[model samples]
Target: MTGVPASAAGGTGRTVPRGKLGTAAVNQASLWNIANILTMVRLVLVPAFVVLLLQDGGHDPVWRAWAWAAFAVAMITDVFDGHLARAYNLVTDFGKIADPIADKAIMAAGLICLSSLGDLPWWVTGVILFRELGITLMRFWVIRHGVIPASRGGKMKTLAQGTAVGMYVLVLTGPLATFRFWVMTVAVVLTVVTGLDYVRQAVVLRRRGLAAERADAAAKAGQRA
Candidate 1:
């Protein structure tokens, strides 16, 4: 009927509870959001990239370059997804949790593969992978208290690693071999610096008792309320 609200309609033309449609709309919005979808896409690409890298044909310089290019694209998606989420106010808990995991997995797998192929030094990969895993575990440990936001140094570390790995792959070409080594060396230095910075931040947080202090303050305010 012309008088019926848009949310209500049926064969019998009966009116439904208005709140149901509103809740459904909210649920649908939450489920199909851009940020969460991008996170899932990133996670899916990790395994595909790994498979491509592991295949025997992947040893060819051309194939390796393509694989690395695919990886770089995936990594770029990681950057853009976060930027879009924050810039457009599309952030979600799903994104926050999955994005870092996807990043660590992709980078770790790539490094491991490169190491196995004897293309990169194991020690360098080991140091970076260990730091990534350690920080990820720390995030889980502190997640109950609150999120530790990504620091500027941490972001720079990611950029450095990506650039280094990309250059390393490009260096597979005979002409660029020496340049790749230098790029990788720079990346390794950045990785160590950023890792230490994260450790320092954790120590500062503990010393200030920021999370506990905030919790206590919240409780006291609640009591007063």
Candidate 2:
């Protein structure tokens, strides 16, 4: 793209085989993509997921079913959007911000609503939410230094949390109830542990950044002298 012809030929994706045209096409292309569209759709469903989950307090199986369906679909979108973006080279700055927000918003709505219905413990939901928010904030806090990449533990945490919350949303009875409880316990543990790990990394990164800045400053001072 850096040296592509200015107006050579038509192309399908982000580039069009031309310089200015390709840049313009890519810039315009950011506005619409399968991944971003899915993300936006997920965000739009948060209210529905919340309202339906709360409507019957999850006592009505039908309402719970609908809520669970919505939550599941939204969660699926969360997984797909990232994969789609990366696979298709459709990643955008907007995607980087919106994807995580959409993920947390859906999860938050589910956890809070489920807890409100007494299906989940308020304290448990609170802890998970706190961890998620803290790490997200830490991400922005240290982003100038570097990005904290995703980890396997983080993926497991999301899976467990989603499974537990989905089961609770469905108001599953009998042995499934116990299973949900255990999954949630695991999720809570991972959430806290991974969150602490992120905090520790952030501290290390901030220190490194400060050291680099100071070193550069001292180098400049020595040169001046």
Number of the top-ranking candidate, with TM-score as the measure: 2
Regions of candidate 1 where Cα sits further than 4 Å from its true position: 1-24, 144-146, 210-225
State the lDDT of candidate 2 residue by residue for 1-225, as single tens digits. Answer: 354533444443343434666588788988699999999999998998888877744588898899899999999999999999999899988898899999999999988887877778899999999999989888999889898899998998899889888988886778988888888899899999989988998999999998998999999999999
lDDT of 1 by residue, 95-156 (tens): 77788888887788788878887888999899998888887777666655456788887887
Q: Please, what is the whole-model Cα lDDT of each candidate in the order they appear?
A: 0.76, 0.87
Instruction: Estimate candidate 1's alpha-carbon lDDT, on a 0 to 1 scale.
Output: 0.76
Per-residue lDDT, model 1, residue 22, is: 67
Lowest-scoring 10 consecutive residues by lDDT in candidate 1?
1-10
Using Cα atoms with residue i matched to residue i, what is each candidate's TM-score against the true structure? Answer: 0.79, 0.89
How displaced is residue 87 in candidate 2, in Å?
1.6
Q: Cα deviation of 115 in candidate 2 (Å)?
A: 1.2
